[model samples]
Target: MSSYKKLIYFTLLLILLVYSVQILNIARFPSQIDIIKGDSRNLNIFFPFSLEIMEESSDIVKINSTNAERLSVGLKNSYNLESTNNGIAKLKLKFLGIFSIRDIQVNVVNQAYVIPGGETIGVKLNTKGVLVVATSEIQSIDGKIYNPARNAGIKVGDSITMINGIKIKDADHVIQLLNNIKNNKVKIEIERNNASFTTEVLPVKSKQDNSYRLGIWVRDKTAGIGTLTFYEPNTKKFGALGHAITDVDTGTLMKAENGEIMRAKVSSIEQGKKGSPGELRGMFFETDDVLGKIENNTTFGIYGTIYDENKLFKQKQLLPVGFQSEVKLGKAYILANIEGDKVTEYEVEILKLEKQNVPQSKSMVIKITDERLKEKTGGIVQGMSGSPIIQNGKIVGAVTHVFVNDPTKGYGIYIEWMLKEAGIYVNNNSEFAEGK
Candidate 1:
């Protein structure tokens, strides 16, 4: 080939290469970002030949970005974005500081100030209805095996709400309704995945007990211990458990018709080991000393209004919620109560961060680095789920799950999602939010 032809070929290849890098740069950069007012975030673009931060509103978000700053190799271009106001701002990202790539909409939210809670609280959850956990075969009075629930299309993870047009209360209520169901086809209303439906079934009399049975196991209530994550001082709301309180046998995310948060004291510890998760055994009064009434149960955590303000553990320092973008990969501490109503600061290191755009349970991977905590309970145990993760004087996230293979490491959830779910003040302007 001639030298001129070779020059043209290399030029075309260079253009293709530039175009691919620019596209990847655009793809990797997030389309939207949220920042707390008065907090500054350093945005680094790893790709060399991409982006100019063109500020549309300096009052909302001030941009001190360098588009022309030269970096040799393996160094990212630095852009400092400072949030100034409690509103929305649009920052334009351009290619070669001229060609418009896309707009990065910035949500400037007010700092979510909350009291960090590490108090081990007793959670008494009364499910919406009787949760059908399992269907079993029963030896009937006719000397035959039958599963009446399976025959009637009742499956596990179903909520049996009503029987014969009467709203069922609990397992005892179902047993009472079984009397009316004996030898008669009864209409049973069930709720699955938030949709309501009904089925008909005839209860069979058990051979051994001589009692009418549906051959299905169900539970209406569950009680357990969990660490409280945070308490919104202004709203009097609290969030706990970091993740949903699922049924042990069926793994169903429990729907709470009503529940309560009470004071609990850790009695003993079951040390966690590989393939065997440990637990913090605690005791609480069921009928007395109710701290708060549970209003919602979600994948993020359990949330509710606190009736007793004195029950919340008072923290020495203030904690404004750290957004997912602000959470750095480094050392952090979790506020946990391992023994006898005493909240202790345990050192933990953040191993990873998930740049999530939406709400999720696992937001970061963390390891227990505190020797004192490891010696007591062998890392993250069962009742430590909602322990608040504190980093840089902020409530970054909460411990949600434990690694069964390695007891020292576990997953944490972003505190922003929990604050939003609990109806705490996060977005300052609803009108501004809705306009976008």
Candidate 2:
């Protein structure tokens, strides 16, 4: 081949090599990371490229130059970073120890520790207002059929906020307001799909009971049993269930304005089978007892502030939070109360993990490895949702779901998302974990 042909082939090879590195850039480096204070973390860097870490704020985070070592092939593969303080630090990454590649924003947050909860707790949640579950025709006193809510364009999942400008407290409150309405057509304030509007619903006197009826079934409260995930003493806040509490009738997320948690003891357990999910039967230790006030009901879980801390739990076991990146696929233990009020530790294994940049429920796949737990509850039962998963002396996540076909297996949500939902991780860089 001629010199010109050889030069052309080399130029093409160089272009392809550069393009490959640019594509690998997306996989090799993180855009941002959360470093725990006083702990060192290693950053992954591939061969053929050495990153020179320069901390913008040396006081917040310092790159450990001592831990940097040259590979057998004379390439830098990783860098160790120590978070010294609770603040944001900028890191200037370089390629081959010379060329600037990109800048990484580091959030050095204090290592947060909280009490890991395992005791079964009874939950009673009241919706913000009356949630319409169904609509039916009402039998009027004059033998007339009237569907007031349906005809007024109210939906099944709609929540009635007020009746004739009076704030609706519950289903019973709406009934009292409807019966006292002197006008035939009553003004109803409805909240549908996050937007609120007023619609006129005709009130009809029932033929049998002589009571005013709206021809709609509205529910204002729900109750169930779940395991507690965590309680942060610093914030006096607690999170539980690892999932939302939805209305059984309308299948809508119960928007909670007020609710309570109570001490509960597991009574019985139904063994799970393939395609058939089992449940843990529990009852409140004390009737009408309020352990805490439920403030918010969300997809993540139910969050609330526990004012009666002394009545809640016996001095609980505290553990640090393990971020998403810190959670590895290995053996872990979970705290679950299977018999009466006794909480026991069971072994579990993390099968898989997802690179989640955003908050999600299914962050890791977990399976029950302890025979004691499996024989007792047939793996993860219904009420075991918020059982705290502990690994490496940290609270890594909470049990969120169980596989219907494989009862021994289930999914867990990282504690990072739960912390944010519980308002304990507010304004901290500790929750941010970028994609690989």
Best model number under TM-score: 1
Query: Which one is best on lDDT?
Result: 1
Instruction: Report the Cα lDDT for candidate 2.
Output: 0.83
Model 1, span 79-138: residue lDDT tens: 788877777777777655567777777777766688898989999999987999999998
lDDT at 10, model 1: 100
Residue 407 miss distance in model 1 (angstroms): 1.9
> How many pairs of residues in model 1 come into backbone collision?
0
- RMSD list, candidates in order: 4.9, 6.1
lDDT of each: 0.85, 0.83
TM-score of model 2 relative to the true fold? 0.81
**CA displacement after TM-score superposition, residue 48 of candidate 1 (Å):** 14
TM-score list, all predictions:
0.81, 0.81
Q: Considering only N, C-alpha and C atoms within 3 Å, which residue pairs clash in candidate 1? A: none
Question: Model 2, range 1-436, lDDT digits (tens) per residue?
Answer: 9999999999988866865775466455666667777777776554445555453578777775532455433333566888877777777666555677677777777778888998899998888888999998888889988887789998899998888888889888887887888438888888887789999977888887998988889899889899999998877999999999988877798889799889888999998888977999998843566778889888889999987777756567678899987999999999999888888899999999987755789999999999998888789999999999999999999999999999999999999889989876654334432110
What candidate 2 gets wrong by more than 4 Å, as runs, is 1-33, 40-59, 62-82, 90-105, 285-289, 427-436
